[model samples]
Structures are given as C-alpha cells and as structure tokens.
Target: MYAGCFLVLSLISFTIQTETAVYIQHRMGWNKAYCMLYFTHGSWSLLWPMQLLILRLQKWNVPWQPFWRRHVAILRSTAQMIQHRTLHLTPRQSQQSPLRYMIWTTAYVTCALTVAGGSWYVAVDMTTASDLTAIYNCSAFFAYVFSIPLLHEKVRFGKVLAVAVAIAGVLVVAYGGKAEESTPKHGGKSGGGAGGPDHDAKEPQNRALGNIVIGIGSVLYGFYEVLYKKVACPPDGCSPGRGMLFANTFGSMIGFFTLCVLWIPLPILHFTGLEKFELPTGDTAKMLLVSVLANATFSGSFLILISLTSPVLSSVAALLTIFIVALVDVMLPGDLATPLSGNAIAGGCLIIAAFIMLSVATYREMDEERRQKEMEVAESEVDEDEA
Candidate 1:
C-alpha cells in the first residue's frame, strides 16, 4: 500500500513540476528576484491550508494525530474504549526518544536556510526558464551523492554510472547553444516604434551568480530529504504522520521568520528605489499560483511517502521528475525546443537507466531483509515447541 502511494506521489510531483516549468517559461517575466520571492512566500503559505485541513479532520474523529501529546491522548482514549467493551491485556508504550527530535530540528533548520538562500539567488540571477529547469535538475545529482554518507544508505555501481550520464545530459542541455529568438508580443506594436529593435541581453555575471545560488540550494535540499527520512522514521513507537505534521509546522514557522528577516532590508532598499522589486505581471501571477499549489502538494505528499518507505526509494523515484519535466517541455506549445543531439539523447537515457537500476537494487535488499527476519521468527517458534 505504501509503495503504491509513493508511486502516485511521484507522478503528482512530476506533473506539478512540469506545469511550474511551463508557467515560468511562458507567463513569468525574466526577473529572478521577483520569481524567487514568489516561490518563497508561496511555499510558506501552503502550511496554513495543510494545518487547517488536519485540524478539521482531527476534530471530526480522524485518527491522524501522531505527535507526543496527541498520540498519548489517542492511546488513552483507545484503551478506555476497548476496556469498556471487553477484557484484554493493555500494553504501555515508551515516550519518543530525544534523537528523533534532534534529527527533525536539524532537518528543518537546514532546509529553511537552503530554500531562502537558493530562491533569493535564483530570483536575482536567472533570465530564462530553461536555465531554471536545468539548475533545478541538479538536485538529483546532489541527492544521489548526499544520501549514501548522510543516511548510511547504499547504491549500486550501475546507479553511480547512470548519475554520471545524467550529469553529462544536463551539460548538453545547459551549454548546447541555441539560436536567440525575438520575444513575441500578444497584441501590440509588431516591433519597437520609437526605439530600434529591443535587444537587452541579460548580464552574464548576474546569470552566473543565480546558478551558483540555486545550485548550492539544491544540494542542501537534496540532503534535507535524507535527514527527513532519518528523523521521521523512529525505531519503535513513533508515528510518521505526527512527526511529519510537526516538522511541517516547525519548518514553516522557521521559514516564515527567516523570510521576514530577509525581507526587512528589501523594503528599505525598495524605498530607496534601488532594488526596485514589484509583483509579477501577466502570466507571472498565474504561474506563481500554479507553482505554489504544485510545490505544496508535492512537498506534503513527499514527506508522507518518505515515512511510508525508505529515503533511497523516494530519492530514486524523484529522478523521474526530470523526465516528466523534459517531456512536458516538448509537449507544450511555446515550450523550449529540446536539441536532438546524440549527446543529449544518450545522457537522458543514461539518467533514466540509472534510476531504474537503483530502484531494483534497493527493492532486492529490502526483500532480502524481510525474508531473513521471517526465517529467524520461524526458527524461534520451532525451538520453543521442541523444548
């Protein structure tokens, strides 16, 4: 059941990411600063809706709460109810361990910092939608690298080799030169009237800076997943749902506070008419709305998926997001043209292959562990009966 849910979550995430990329490409302007701000606030805003829904459901007799206090209340009520109905043994459960809290705190802090820094940098620097997608895709590489050491997870050799191929594909997509085209106006003067043809090129320096910022942010976020898996999955008597709910609440609070601190100087700078930040225009508003919804859904579902399964599987499944985005880019009108170079195709195939190999290897390992545990249980029963 959990595995099926993860697959569904992955598909939903892919759809949302693809739509976000399209919206950014078409409706949103090329201002990195405004884009980053929109994404930052949008992501934080999702917590309110999620919390409201959870609270409402809980009030209506939903057995969803899993945190310290809530879990105790739930167990106590359940015990009382059962005791009234019939006679049975009552078992006591231990309190949540300190290590779990520490892991959650650490993951939340790191993720918040990463999102703030990355979004700010991207907003200031990125000029094109394709650049944004390419940079975002780098998260997979980071995830692959960070998961092994941080989570004590193992990866197959084929998976490593596939990651290299995927990286190569990214280079082809990023640096493979494409012809510049004029921006299409919807219903206005065909060309510049008073001024000659407008050809304001984005500064190379700003673009480079944006890439660096988003890149680092992606790496931090990649590790964030591994950390979440560790903290959310306790050895015994821990509720994954409750842990996630708390993490989201705590993380969002931290994010909101950080954004407030970060935005403090923005108003001052805007007052001086120096930074000159304004709300997005035209399709930008629509894009922001879609991106926000998609991001929130994917993020919430992803945490649930992680709790239900292992981090390695979640990470591997996440790689499919790239394929989804790329496919969407091809299918949508006005989407960026994917260059059909030999290297590009080869690189894409390699990344897909790598994800498949990793998934298979991880599944085999899990199955083996399950079989071993079953065998041990059977042996114990046999010895008891003989005695």
Candidate 2:
C-alpha cells in the first residue's frame, strides 16, 4: 500500500518538475541548467526536517525528550542496518556509529548522482531530442544489469522480459513515427519531459558526442540507484515506517551536501562565464519554486520507493512518467488540440503492461523471501527447544 502511494506521488511530482523545468528554460529564457539542478536537489535537505515535524505533530502529546530520543534511536539502528546490510546486529555493532561511514559514502554517492544529472544538462543542448530521450531512459535496462552483481539479484526470466518490454515501449514512443516529432511531445531530454526549449528543429551541436555523454550518464544513473539501495537502505523485512524515516534522512544528507559542497561550482561556472548566476524574478521565481518543491517531493518519494523495493522496479516505475507527461501536454492550453498519436497510445499501453508484469514478479519474490525467513526462525526455535 505504501509502495503504491509513493509510486503515484513520485510520478505526479516528477511530471510537475519536468514541465516547470521546460517552462523555465523555454518560455522564461532562463536556460541555467546547473542552477536549477542545484536548487531542486538542494531542497532535499528539507525532507528529514519536514518529516520530523510531521512525526512530532502526530505524536504531539509526547514529551520532547523521550520523543527525540526514540526518534534518534530508530534512525541510528536503521543506519547500522544500512552499514552492515543486515537486519540483525550485535551489541558492539549497534554501539558503533556509522555516521562517519555514511558521511563518506554520501559524499561519493552524491558525486555520482551530480555527474549523472549534469550530463543531462550538458547533453540536452548537444543532442537531438529523440536520441536523448531514448538513451537516457535506457537506464532501466542498466539498472537490471547492475542488480545481478551489486544486488545479488537472480536472473529471472519474467523480470528480464518486463524490462525489455518497457524499453521497447520507450523506443516506440521515442522513434516510432517521425522519430523527431512524436518524441519531443512525449519524452524530453532529461528523461523527464520536453526536449530542449523550442529550438529542437535545429541541427544538434554534436549528436555523436551527446549520445556518448548521455550513455555514460545512463550507466552512472543506474549505478547510483543501485548503490543507494545497497549502501543506504535497511535490509528486507524492515517496517515501512522505519524505511520511510531512513529514506528521507538519507535524502536530506544528499540535499545538505548539495547545499554545502556543490556551491563551489556555481562561482566557477560564473567566473568561466559558462553559466552566469542570476536571480529569477516574478513568475520565473514562482515557477522555479514550484519546480524545486515538486522535484524534492519526487526525489524523496523515489528514495522511499527504492528503499521499500528493488532499484529495478523503481527505475521502471519512473518510465511511467513519460506517458503521463505526454498526456499532460495534450491538456495544456496551447496543445489541447494535439491529440496523442497512435504510437503514443501503443507505447503507453506497453509501458503499463510491463509495470504490472514487473510488479507481480517483485512481490512474489518478496513474499517467498518472507516465508523463507519465517521458516528459518521457526527451525532455529525448534533446535533451541530440543537442545
């Protein structure tokens, strides 16, 4: 139930973020990609604080000292679980602080995520819209590939088919009919929505180079997701509440890192005159805020979803937004008359079908894991009684 709810939230907020990002760049003429990325990601630092506030309000009658202590303890235990990658921990292990380790891990992981995201910003101007959309969404396939070794995920036929189908749908949507036309209306450059502003008809600055950059970004993006799942998430069987708390806390760490460490680049970019810093005014500021908040919501929810499930599932789930944003575009003021193409309908159906298929496979695997764990516990208890 929690998974379903967060999935929906992530998809909706992502759509909003993508639309606002496009508007900021295209309509407002503020093509400051790095600045937008920084703001959106930096907002993640608020996740934990916001979550803490909500939790406190829920337990409003509780005294501060006990409430704070209990909250800290839960986070601490979850952090330990993340560090050790196990549910059970020894007393000594529990006492040991994973804070320093988590900090170092967060630093490197954030670097990977920043670079992966930066690639999209850099490539958007250089590549064709269709190429950018198709290649970046390929991260879903990479996620599955990385899962085998990093996550010890078995090679399941059902999962393979689902992932393949999802990618096929993306291609159909991206390059199906008039690869140039349909793709821009649906999947955009950053794999979110919308191609570059409105000048996509122009020749790409360097299509070959852009594809290579985005290709690397696709692989790195997949790696980042799997790394987060392995290094930050508690092991299977963790309570949903605990998982949610930890996920937001980790998201805040990423946001806080962006705020502190990532600021160094802004001045450098400004000095280089590559992307001069400028404050957005009036409607741009308002829309930018909306975009940032939407991105924060989407990022936090995505982290929670990944924590609660496998990275493969979350990556594929994100693909649903491509179809959703397309539908949203159809309803917008100027494009209301532009109905979805036959290819769009066909591709959307394929993506949805793939999601359902993958969901069933994942849940079945989780259930089997739960039953196996229960059997192990029961057998251990019987052995102890006999002894």
Candidate 3:
C-alpha cells in the first residue's frame, strides 16, 4: 500500500518537475542547469526535519526530552544498519560510530548521482530527443542486470521477460511513430535539473558521441540505484515505517552533501562564464520554487520506494512517467499539447502489462523469503530444545 502511494507520488511529482524545468528554461529564460540542480537536490535536507515534525506531532503527548532522545536513537540505529548493510549487529559494531561511514558513503553516492544526472545535460545537445529518451530509459534494463551480482538477485526467466517487454515499450514510444520533418532549432537552455533534452535545440553535431556518453550515464545511473539499495536500505524483514524513516534520513544526508560540497562548482562555473549565476525573479521565481519542491517530493518518494522494493522494480515503474508525460502534453492548452500517437497507446499498454507481471513476481519472491525465514526460526528453536 505504501509502495503504491510512493510510486504515484513519484510519478506525479516527476512529471510536474519535468514540465516546470522546461518552462523555467524556455519560457522564463533561466538556463542555469547546475544551479537548478543544486537547489532541488539541496531541498532534500528538509526531509528529515519535516519527518521529525510529523513524528513529534504524532507523539505530542510524550515529554519533549524523551521524545527527542528517542528520535536521536532511532536515527543512530538506522544509520548503523545502513553502514553495515544489515539489521543485526555485534556489540562492538553497534558501539562503533556509524557517522564517519555514513558521511563518506553519502559523499561518494551523491557524487555518483550527480555525474549520472549531469550526463543528461551534457548529451542533450549532441543527440536527438528520441535517442536521449530511448537510451536513458534503458537504465531500467541495466538496473536489473546490475542487481544480479550487486543484489544477489536470481536470474529468473519471468523477470527477464518483463524487463524486455518494458524496454520494448519504451522503444515503441520513442521510435515507432512515423518520421516527420525536423522543426527549426532555437537557442535555448539545453538541459534542466533532471537533465531532460531541449527539443528546440539544433541538430546533434555528433550523434555517435552523444549516444556513447548518455549510454555511459545510463549504466552509471543503474549502478547508483543498486548501490543505494545495497548500502542504504534496511535488511529484509524491516518494518515499513522504519524503512520510510531511514530512507528520508539518508535522503537528507544526500541533500546536505549537495549543499556543502557541490556548491563549489557554482563559483567556478560563474567565473568561467560557462553558466553565469543569475537568480530567478517574478513568475520565474514562483515557478522555480514549485519545481524545486516538487522535485524534493519526488526524490523522497523515490528513495522510499526503492527501500521498500527492488531497484529493478522501481526503475521499471519509473518508465510509467514517459507515458504519463505524453498524456500531460496532450492535455496542455493551445500549441503546447503534443498529439498522442498510436505508438504511445501501444507502448503504454505494454509497459503497464510488464509492470503487472513484475509486481506479481516480486510479491511471490517476498512470500517465499518470508516462509523460508519462518522455517529457519522453527529449526533454530528445535535445535535449542534438543540442546
């Protein structure tokens, strides 16, 4: 239930974020991609605080000191689980500080995320939007591949087939439509925080190069997702609330790193005039705020979803956004709406079908794991009695 809610939240916010990014760059003429990325990522820092407020409100009857202490302990214990990648810990391990490990992990993980995300901007001008969409979304396939070794996920035929179908759907949506004459290109901001393509940009100077770069980015993005699952997510059998809390806490750590370390590039970019620093005002500022908040919401929900489910599932679920975005475009007023192609209808159905198959498979996997654990527990109790 929580997983479904998070998925919906992520899909909605991601669509809104994508559209606002386009508006901010094209309509408002604020083309600072890095700045937008910085602000949105930094907003993650608010998650923990917001969570704390909600938690406190829930326990309003409790004494302040006790509530605060309990909150600190919960965070510390969850941090330990993340650092060690398990819920069980030895006395020595529990006593040792998880702070250093967490800080280092958060730093490197955020670095990976930034690079993977930045690739969108770097390649957007160098490739067709069709290529960008198709290639980047291929991260869903890579996520499943990486999960085999990194996550110890068994190579099940059902999962492989589902992933294949999902990718096919994406291809259909991207390339199945009949070709039309290319529109005249305009000089505008080429990428946004999420690294979306600037469709209005000139033709690619080097299609081959852009494809290769974005391809690397796609692999890296998948690796990042699996890595987070391995390093940050709580071990199996953890309660949903605990998983959600820790997910937001870890998200805040990412946000904190972005604010403290990633800001260094802003100055360098400004000095080099690669992207001069300029603040948004008027409607631009209003819309930018909305976009940033929406992104924060999406990021938080996405993290929680990954913690609750497998990265492969989360990545495949994200593909739903492509169809949703198309639907949104169709709803836009005047010239903004892109006509819904037959390919989109066909592709969207395939993607949905794939998601249903994968979801059933995942549920069965979880049930089997649960029963196996129960058996192990029963066997352990028998052995203790015999002793």
Find the candidate with the highest TM-score and give its number. 2
lDDT of 2 by residue, 1-387 (tens): 999999999989888988887777777888786888788889999999999999999999999999999999999999998898888999989999999989998899899888888887778777877787788888889989999998999999999999999999998887776657432533322233334554357777698999999899989888899999988899877899999999999999999999999999899999999999998999999998888888889999999999989899999999898888878878889743346778877888999999999999998998888899899999999999999
Question: Candidates' lDDT values, in order?
Answer: 0.50, 0.85, 0.81
**TM-score of every model?**
0.65, 0.95, 0.93
Clashing pairs in 1: 32-123, 33-123
lDDT of 1 by residue, 90-197 (tens): 343223233344434544644554463345333323433335435555655676677788666677676676566565555554444441222211100000001111
Q: Which sections of candidate 1 miss by over 4 Å?
A: 1-138, 175-215, 232-265, 268-275, 280-286, 310-312, 334-345, 379-387
Ranked candidates, highest TM-score first:
2, 3, 1
What is candidate 3's CA lDDT for residue 165?
A: 94
In angstroms, give how far residue 185 of model 3 lies from its true place. Answer: 16
Off by over 4 Å in 3: 178-202, 384-387
In order of lDDT, best first, we have 2, 3, 1
- Candidate 3 residues 140-218, lDDT tens each? 8888999999999999988999999998998888676741222211111112334333542656678889889889888
lDDT of prediction 1: 0.50
TM-score of 2: 0.95
* Candidate 3 backbone clash number: 0
Error of 3 at 278 (Å): 0.9
